[model samples]
Target: MTAIPNETMAIIAGGGHLPQLVLEGARSMGLRVVGVGFAGETDPSLADSMDAWQWQNLGQLGKLIAFCKKQGVSRIVMAGKIHKARAVDLRPDWRAAKLLWKVKNTQDDVLLRAITGELESEGMSVVSAMDFLPHLRSPEGVLTRRGPTSEEQADIDFGWPMARQIGALDIGQCIVVRKRTTVAVEGLEGTDATILRAGELVGPGCVVIKLFKPIQDARLDLPAVGPKTIQTMIEAKASCLALEAARSLFIHLEESLTLADKAGISIVGLRS
Candidate 1:
C-alpha cells in the first residue's frame, strides 16, 4: 500500500476477488492493468478488464514473464489463492523446471521467494496484493460486538503460538482450537475448509486463529479473510476469530463485521 503506479502495472491474478480488486484499484489510480492468470486459478471473465491479458499454466514461468515484458510491465502484484496441492498438476516448462531444480524444498515461502528473485532479476518487482487492496487490512482492535470471552481468550493464547510454530515450520497459517485442544490445522485445503473441518470434528464453540507466519514475506502474501470467511464460520457455528491485527487482510470489512456481530461471534484483532 505504498505509492500506486501511474504507468501500467501487472496483475498476476489468481481466482475470486483478486483480479477484480486489483483492476478496480489500478483503474481508480489511473494505472492501466496488464494481467496474466494461472490457467485453473484465475477467473476468465476478468480478461475484459486487462489492457493485455493471457491465461498461463502453472509452470510456464517463461511464457508468463515474456507476456508481461511484451506488455512493458515493470511491477507485478500477485493476488488470490494458488493451491499448493496444485503442484500435482504442474506442467513445468524449461524455465520453471530450472527454477524448481534449484529449490531445496517446495514450501510456499521458499518457492514464492525464489519466484520473486526470478522476477526481480528480470527487472520486474513483485509487490503484495495488499498494495492494491489496502482497505481490507484489519487494524488492531476488537472488530465485532464483543471481544473474546475469558475461555475463548484462553484458547487464543493457547493456539496463537501453536499457530506460529506450524508457521515457522512453513506448514500453514491457521489452526483451530477449543478449550486448548487442537481441532484441525490447515493443510493446504485453505482456511475456510479448515474451519468447516474443525466444526465437523468438534461441533460448535470452536475458536479459529489465523496468523501471519513469522517468516512470511511482507511484500508478498499476507493471509486473507473476508465476509465469506465469516459466513463460513457462521455455518460452522464457530464462536470466535482471533486474527493477527495489522497483519491480516479483512476484505469486505463492514459486511464481515456485520455478519460476525449478528452471529454473536467475537472477533478480536490479535496484535503480535
Candidate 2:
C-alpha cells in the first residue's frame, strides 16, 4: 500500500482514546497534525500532542473549518465519540444552524453527511480514520484466547443482523442478546449502558454484538471496541463479543484481549 504523503492533516477530535491514536499514527507517518477538539467531548490532554490545536464547541462548524484552513490542512479525519444526546443540546453557530436547517432529520448519518458535504465544499477532503491507522482494524476470527462455544455462537448469529439493521437505520450499532433473545438495543445511551441494561433484564451469559452500519460512511463513526469495552462486558457478565472484521476498530487490543481472556470472555471478528 502507498503511504499517505507527509502533509498537515486536520483531526476533528471528539471523545475517547481514538483521537490520540490517530494523532500518533499521523505523526509516525511523518505528517503534521492540527487538531480541532470539542469542548466537553474531547480529552483535554489531546492538546499537548498536536502540532497545533483549537478547542471548539460541538456546533462550531465555522470555527473548525477556519482553523483547518489557517493551519493549511487539506485532508481531514474525524476520530472519537460525540454523544448524540449532547448533540441535541448544541448551540449551533450560523454555519452549523444553516446545515441543520437543511437536513430533514438529525439522525447520526444525516447530520454527519451534511457536515462532510460542507467540509468538502470548502475544499477539504475527509479521509477514513482507518487509512491513517489500519492496524486498529480488527482481523477476522477469534481474537481472545477463549473462542465462543456453540451456544454463544448461536447468540451471535441471532444478534448480528439485528444490530446491523438498527445501525443501518441510524438507531445504534450495538445489541445485547442472551440465548437468541435480544435483551437490549443500544440507543443514545451507548454501548456500555445498553450492556448494563441487558444484564439487568437477562442476567449473565449475554452476547454483545457491535458492527458497522450497512450504509455507514467509512470516514465517520466506525464501530470501535477497546479495553473499556471488555471491562464493561466483565461488569455486565456478558460472555461474548462479535465485532465486524476490517470494518470495526479495536483499540488497546493487547490489553483488551488479555482482560477478555482472564474473564473467559470470547471475542470473535466476523466478516459480515
Candidate 3:
C-alpha cells in the first residue's frame, strides 16, 4: 500500500541473472538497496553490489525481518528464482514455522502471500520488481523470426486458457501442449525443467505456454522468460512459446529472439 520508497529497500535476492539486473535498476533510481540472499540458491558474489547485505538460509523469517528493521529498510522487493522444492532442506525458525502452520497448503501463492503479509505486518512494503524493471515486460507480438504456424497457433490457443486455469488454481504458471494435447504441467522443478520433460514425453513440436497467475500479487512473482527459456525450448525441441504479453517479464529479449530464430523456434507474446 506504500508508494515506492525513495530512501531504502531490501531485495530478497534468490537466484539467476535477475537479481543483478534488479540491483542495477534500483541504482538507476537513486535508491539504496540492501541485498538479502538465500543460502545455496543466491550467487554470493552478488553481495559486492549491495550497500549492505546478508547471506541467510531459508526458513529464517525472523532473521530476515530483524535485519530489515535494523537496517531501516521499509520497502522489500522479492526478485529472482527460489526453488520451492528446496523446502525439504528448510529449517524454520519460530516465525517461519508459525507461518507454515498458518497456511492450509504449501502452494506457491498461499505460502508467498503469507510471507508477504508477515513482512507488511512488520511495517515494510512488499513491492514489485516490475516497477523498477518495466522494460522487461513481454511485449505483445511475435518475438522471433517466425510466428507460430497455424497448427502451432491452434496449440497455443488451446493451451493458453488451460495455462491460465492452472494458474488460477495456484498450481503453476507453465504447461506444455502438442496437437492440443497437454504434455506436461509445471511443478516445483520450474518452467525449464517442465519443457524438457515434455520433450521426453511428446518429442518435438510442443508449444510451451506461460502465464501470470490470475490471483497472484502484482508486486511479486511475475512470470519471466528469456534467453534461458529459448535455450530450454531449443533443447526440448519445442516448436513455440506463448507468454502472457505485458504481464510476463521477457528478459534479454534480443538475445532470446536470436536464439529462438536460430533454433527455428517461434516465440509469441499473447494477450491474456
RMSD of each: 1.5, 1.3, 1.6
Q: Can you give the TM-score per candidate against the true fold?
A: 0.95, 0.96, 0.96
In candidate 2, what are the lDDT values of residues 141-254, reduced to their tens digit? Answer: 999888999999999988888888988899998999998998999898889899988888888899999999998999999999999999999999999999999999999899
Candidate 3: pairs in clash: none
Please, what are the lDDT tens digits per residue for candidate 3 over residues 33-92? 898998788999999989999988888999999999999998899999998799656899
The C-alpha stretches of model 2 lying farther than 4 A from their native spots are: 1-6
Q: Which order, best to worst by lDDT?
A: 2, 3, 1
Candidate 3 lDDT: 0.90
TM-score for candidate 2, please give it: 0.96
List residue ranges in candidate 1 displaced over 4 A: 1-6
The C-alpha lDDT values of all candidates are: 0.87, 0.90, 0.90
Q: What value of lDDT does candidate 1 attain over all alpha carbons?
A: 0.87
